[model samples]
Target chain A: MDTVCSINNLARCLVEGGFSPDLANLLTLLGGVVLVATIPLVTVIFLIWIERKVAARVQDRLGPNRVGPVGLLQTVADALKMLTKEDITPTGADKFIYNLAPVIAFATVILMWAVVPFTPLHIGADVGIGVLYFMAVASIGTVKIMVAGWSSNNKYALLGAFRTIAQLLSYEVPLVLSLLIPVMLAGTMSLQGITEAQGGMWYLFIAPVAAFLFYVANLAETGRAPFDLLEAESEIIAGYNIEYSGFKWGMFMASEFLHAFTAALFFAIIFMGGWWGPFVQEVPLLGALYLVGKTAIVYVFGLVLRATVPRVRIDQLMALNWKFLVPLAIANVLVIAFLIQVLKALGLMPVPGADIIAHLPMTVVMLLGNLVIIAVAMQVLRNQGREEKMAQEARMAARQQRVVKEVRTPAGAPVGD
Target chain B: MLEFNASTVAFVVMTLFILGGALGVVTTRNLIHATLYLILSLFGVAGYFVLLSAPFLAAVQVLVYIGAIAILIVFAVMLTRSMTRMSEILNGQWLLSAIVGAGLFLLLVIGVILPTWGNGGLLDATVSAPSQVVIDTVDLGKALVDRNGFVLPFEVASLLLTAAMIGAIVIARDDTE
Candidate 1:
């Protein structure tokens, strides 16, 4: 056990202790996986509690103070309650798929943890295609929603699934486009590489528009407000998981909370420089603390937004994605790519592995490029808003004229006819 | 006889996924179930790409095929009435369709196996082992845009996709508006 400091050490120790090499390697790999997987499972309990407290605070209420000191054990109690509750299966529901959906929903989120770089030294797998792997796993989450909705054998569930698919599939375009920025800047799709590359300066400074786009798209991706049309309680009940109950429903809820946190974690890693802070290189464990701190900030922001913002209508949601985010993301990518090339040609770009000071010139140029795009986009939005307001006023005026005419002609008379 | 190695075990598992999923797709009475099965099959192919050491390709396969294509198919199935379940598995042209399917399968088998057989049967191809060949994703990205590489074909493919997207929008647009 003393040799279990790292997976490699553990495997080596086992091999030296007379265990077969293959068996030792397999055991260590399994142990590493279980260790990584448990972090989310354990953290999600605290996250749910934190979310409730934040929401309660924003809405002027105390949240679960009775469960334990500061309501620390509230999520545990809720989990117990959920477990003891009766599980119901609707008549005519596809039982296999209904059972499978929650599992997939929970598993998909956990699978994403495989690629998350917690520290410079700690990662689950550090796969070469980490970013794309995250995208792929996130996409599978849609299928889980679809399965849940379809298997529930309810109209509301089906409608919720449809909305979920539309919202998820639409938001994914901008999400992927925004993700490319970090990949391009780092010249690697692996999350660890991206984090390392951001050591000089976080991509948030270099490509603020892309960061903004990623944040917005991530909010939509996680089905959080104001883009949370999928489960709009007033309209679709509980959405895809409407038919689920007991621990099954708990699984869906747990996954949703965890997914939101994971998105924040990825956002922090991609844009805020994951595991990179003063003295972090000397102490790898401190890097984990930095990652957690960054994730917490982003997560709290998401919770506050969710608490404050009203959910957008389905049409507005679609319009925002296709009309605004998608186009803006595309333009941002193109501009950034062009700027990188120009900087390189002019010898202004920082050499690979340069320090923060060396990155200043290139970062400044890219930041200005992003600011210009943002300014232009704001102007376009302002013009569009004014035009829409004028159209509304004209329509109101015409309606007023018609009403006045009707009153002058006497009500119910055939004067217009 | 196949070697009892990790790769062999993984390959066997992937083969099961692909074949089982394919069988389930055709045999299922429900359209939604069939689509799900198709996704499973596609996912197995992605697994094969991973096994072949092309993690980038594997990820793209899952993203594009299982994520986008299968979801679109599911949406389409849900949109059409009475498409989820069918009472009859066979249509009037089942016999003709079966013959076509069989022919296509045979052609695929011959095309895949013939070239490999000339060397040392299907199992002993000249392709290097996955562990022996390491291709960095950065190299893959460069090759896509490199002047002497896939730049022309890549641009052309993207252009074709753009054209197709515009055509779709045009067809779906409300002419009265």
Candidate 2:
């Protein structure tokens, strides 16, 4: 089963076919690096087109229908334009650092793909610390944004970068905390191992709240709507990348597009039983298709959210992360850990078996726990809403009374009245 | 004569990153630039951890140190507008600090070299062993939680972290009154 997509098997086959060992190994490594790099670059072209189409549809307008079938070549044309446009460097800006930031931003996301398991056989490294690698590489992005903002020598860019770092840092707590559920449940940090462990059932059913927290945190991490203060187009005029032009600006856009999709991909892999479908284990290429299919679905969901939701105030963003998501993530982790331990003790924990139906009992228990957590969260949200409503009504009533008193006092009214 | 092997090349490149970044950190007048150099140095340290077959440590190094701590340091640096463009790279304590730094470097070099020199053959034997032992992530996870392992220390560390977090929040909060 593991042999189907494995680069090791391919290398061995090459060796058996009379290729030198060193050459085979080198070729395999090179092929993997190339594949990982190309997948995102190629996909971003399509992703941008899809994002525009989706956003347009949601806004009740006709998207690109020119250049190719339904404007498919729009991104390609954009890429061409970006390539030909003038590259400008602002005077007094730190030129080297400013130039380096976009490359860093683009490269960091690609580095994350190095750990992504596309199919059973198609992993780059399959490192023991795969999940952590994703987090670590993603974190490097903050530095890149900082460099971009700081080196721009512009106040708005600096403010945008500041907001970005604050939002990213605040949300990272819950992001990491939510990731612990899968790590704990699978008992492995390896993404492939997590995927394989979910052979019986996806972690989404087992830990819905954790998955939800991860999704929200990821949205914030990617600076998507409700958390898009990083750019907040109307306010900061493109935030960190305002000074960048041409393909340098295009690279930042591409990285943002790639980052959003990457978050969805990670969500699919960790929670949605990545590459687990009919005959995927037998035919590994099918696994790749399944992964892509799931990632697209998740990606579209994120796009919908982006197009629909209003951006949150920076204070609200911070409060949501620190007060709500962080605590909820922590509580969810504790609940899951305790439940797992208790289930194991009672010998009620289901084995990772081929039969997906056998997972129902365990799933039901987890679902119940998730329900409790969700209920608590709803209660908190309802309370906050009620308090706001009451405060608004009180202010309205006080204003009305003041208006009536003013009318009663003839001196307070206009002399003509 | 140039004898090229993978590890040696990697080691040499990583050493350059470490040394160059450390040099940049100390000599750069711009605080933000210094912080970026510090990240580069930290990244090199993480690479060393990977070379040492401690990938978990390397990940932790990146996740905690580079990700959280370095970012926090940069955040702090950026917040103070005046600190970003420093007029001086060296202060009054430069000479004394240089001497102390040199002394510390010498001591560390000697400490590392003396033991390595004594155990060079043993180290080579271990390195050339057919099956090099590796501590996997599972073992680390288990060790952290097991009663006879590091459970006590681990819990205490968490408690300390929580306390520190609370203290930070309290100190940072604005006084409404």
lDDT of 2 by residue, A10-98 (tens): 78877777798988887888887997889899999999999999999999998888979889999999999999999999998999999
How do the residues A1-417 of candidate 1 rate in per-residue lDDT, one tens digit apiece?
546555648888888789999998889999999999999999999999999999999999998898988999999999999999999999989999999999999999999999888888999999988999999999999999999999999999999999989999999999999999998888888899999999889999999999999999999999999988878999988898999999999999999999999999999999999999999878887999999999999999999999999999999899999999999999999999999999999898887678999999999999999999999999999999999999999999999999999888776576655
Q: Which stretches of candidate 1 lie over 4 Å from their true place?
A: A1-8, A411-417, B118-124, B127-134, B170-177
Each prediction's RMSD to truth: 2.6, 3.6
For each prediction in turn, the share of the native Cα contacts (below 8 Å between chains A and B) that it retains comes to 0.78, 0.63
TM-score of chain B of each: 0.86, 0.82
The DockQ of each candidate is 0.84, 0.71
For model 2, residues B25-53, the per-residue Cα lDDT tens digits are: 99888888888899999999999989888
Docking class of 2: medium
Off by over 4 Å in 2: A1-20, A402-417, B1-4, B119-134, B170-177
What TM-score does candidate 1 get on C-alpha atoms? 0.96
